[model samples]
Target: MEEMAIVFSPKYYEHNTGRDHPESSRRLKTVMRELKRLNLFSATTGCQLVEPELASIENLELVHDPEYVGLVKRICELGGGLLDLGDTVVSPKSFEVARYAVGGARKAVDSVLDGNYQKAFALVRPPGHHAGPYYGAGFCVFNNVAVAAAYLIEQHSFERVLILDVDAHHGNGTQEIFYDSEKALYMSLHEDPREFPGTGFVDEVGEGAGLGYNVNVPLPFGTGDEEYMKAFDEVVVPVARQYEPQFVLVSVGYDSHYGDPVGKLQLSAAAYESIFKKTLDLASTVCQGRLVAVLEGGYNLGQLGKLAALTISRMADFSYSMKDGTPPANSNVARRARRVIEKVEKAHSAFWKLRA
Candidate 1:
């Protein structure tokens, strides 16, 4: 398998968010600038810049509401407005930027479909995972990764797509869209229900035929490096192996980084590095490394810079340094995370044969 990694950057379109917003344009600028300094983007014998193409509304409708899709277009036409409950702002360029978000996802799918690359990373913003089929929340417009997954199902006829969300917050929107389908498995590792947008409880397996397809491992606050890795080994990797997915898509949010303003989890850069490496290894065994990761959230520009570089390097087979030592994993948090994982395993034992 030929391993190639592509980063989709549309920082020029990051114009709608306010100056002080945590998900500001500077976040994208910071990642891009740091990646450049790290030289993973060299034009000579290095990462190639991949141009983005606009995703079709027909494709977008695969995962979003028609009226909601129309509303986004209309709001974008209104020059500037709020899409979410004031968390997401939209300007004339907002629609254009949102298109790039979707575009980057679609392009990544295309590259994989065309046999040009084994792995790709859509380093985009206006982070998704909070937006649903009919509503947008938490600084998101269209559910970019969901749109790509749906597009693959409809057009390419690819079955068995696994969405692995490592965001500190639950990917409620993504879970809602594919909740009742067995063809797609939605799993997430997030802070417990006490956290924001609070909906990912253990009992919320799924409704109808999709029973047991959704897995939610809610880690307690202050969960850091060791706790996160233990959860991965004890839960994430095993569940993924049992699913035997044909393709993998990750919602790679770095908001779990220790110093992130909006996040309470203490996953340091070392923890992030471990997960990145492990996920790539999982992709290798499952989809011949046919995995695509999108930027979700990481507030501290310094931490984001370090984590993003580590993500690119691992997926691209480059070398990098891990932080000296990650924050200590709490014993209480570990106990809580394991309980959550065991409950999920019991719930879905029939589906994926998850071991306790």
Candidate 2:
């Protein structure tokens, strides 16, 4: 088994959202270029680039409504249009490409579960977290990580899957999908929802059996590495340990980086590295290193690829570094982040043992 596997396909580039669009083929192109420049596929890195198969309709229906799945297919077949109101543009080939993206995510999970790799990262495009059971939005066409988690439970008969979303925007769709179930715990750390998709507030914890399973840490704008790491240490790590997930999945989004144009939070590449390393350690502690990360957001073409490559290197335990300027310290932002973390801890205290 390789140390890590990267699920990607050149075909992901065919899903054209538009040349000028933030979620364009250029993003993947840049990421691939950086991966190659770093020699990530070399044996020394113990990483292999694996192409993904198209996801079957049955697999898609595991999470999404059949009608919604068919709608996306039909829309793409009819020469592609917007999957959502405006941002989620699709082309004639987008349906297939989106399936390939989902396929890539699933492939990553399978690779880790099969013991072929300790961990895997699905570097496909057309991000998925914004899409839900019946709709796609925010440049997302399908909930790739959601489907992967559902697949692990339904197909593999595994329970207790944990999804850790570090996207700058809340994965409202992923949360909604699993909001009523205990099989999957959805935790997200993102900018305040008032600034983005307008959801994932601290009080919007899960319902029914999943009442305490949904964890959201909505930070203030200008939050940097220190605040983010503190949230991970105080809130994320404790909740995750209590859940004791059988497998871990991360919605890896780099838009929170200080360089990203789409997101408002200020996170340095080093912050992302620390987050990834912490996630890897968390998985190793709870799930024997069974983890898979799927691409969700990150629009800055110049920095997206470098961050993606850095994440892959971290997964492979390969040493690679890049500096994308630091975010200035803001004591005010740190205080706000602490408040949010405290609220989140209080909100979920009934569900998990958050404090000693």
Candidate 3:
């Protein structure tokens, strides 16, 4: 069995959100170049590369409304346009590319579950996590990670699926999609929602049966590796250990890196490596190493490629380090993050025990 797999498709670059858009085709191009530079294609790495097929309508309906799906297809068929109130845009081929992205995520899930790979990373584009059941938002036309989670539940009969979203922005659409579902636990570590989609408040636990299943740790601006690691150790680690999911899916977004232009968080490539190591450890202990990471957001080309390469390297039990000289967190941000963590723990305490 392969230790790592990268789900990619040339069709992903055909989405064509726009030339000036932050989520552009050039993002994947830079990532591919970096992976090649790192010699990931060498025969010794044992990393399998899989090109995925386009997702079927049946699969898309698992997370998206049929009408919304039709609208996206029709819009793309008519030569494409803006998709939502946010940054989501589409060209003539975006619908196809978006479907392929979803398919790539699903393929990753299948590969991991079938023991073909211990872990897989879907490198396709038109980043998801922002697209909800009814609308596309934040450059996401379809919720790829959510679809993969739902697929695991319905197709594979998995009971608990954990989605760890490390995007700078909260995965509002993903939280919304699975808010009422106990089958999937959605946890997001993001910059404060007052800045972006405005949803991942500490108190906004899930609605019904999923009331405690959705966890949000909203950090302050200028939050760096120290603050983030603190939050993860205090909140994420405890909650994940209790949930004990059968599968783990990460909404991998490099925008949280300090070098990224879209997000203000002070994370470096080393921070990303640390995050991946923690996640892989959790998957190994609880889920039998059934983990898959799907691309969500990252605007900067240089950091995006480096962070991703470092993550995959770590997945293969190797180390590739890059330091971006991330700044230290101030006392104010640390205080704010501590307060947020407290609020999240108090709110989720009704559902999950805060400590291991």
In order, the Cα lDDT scores of the candidates are 0.79, 0.90, 0.89
Candidate 3: which stretches are off by over 4 Å? none
Among these predicted structures, which one has the highest lDDT?
2
Per-prediction TM-score: 0.94, 0.98, 0.97
Candidate 1 clashing pairs?
Answer: none
Give the range of the ten consecutive residues with the poorest summed lDDT in model 3: 317-326
Per-residue CA lDDT of model 2 for 1-356, tens digit only, reads 24898899999989988768988889889999998988788888899988898999999999999999999989998998988766799899999999999999999999888888898899988899989999999999989999999999999988899999999999999999999999999999999889568898999888999888898999998898888888899888888888899999999999999899988889998888999888888888988999899998998988998899889878888788987778679998899998888888888888888862
lDDT of 1 at 292: 88
lDDT of 3 by residue, 1-356 (tens): 24788999888989997778889989999999888887886777768789887899999999999999999999999999998766688999999899999999999998887888889999978888989999999999999999999999998898899999999999999999999989999999999889789899988889888879999998888898888988888888889989999999999999999888998788877778888889989999998888899999998987788888887888877657776776766888888888888888888887888742
Q: Better model by TM-score, 1 or 2?
A: 2
Candidate 2: misplaced stretches above 4 Å? Answer: none
**Alpha carbon lDDT at 180, candidate 2:** 93
Q: What does the lDDT come to for candidate 1?
A: 0.79
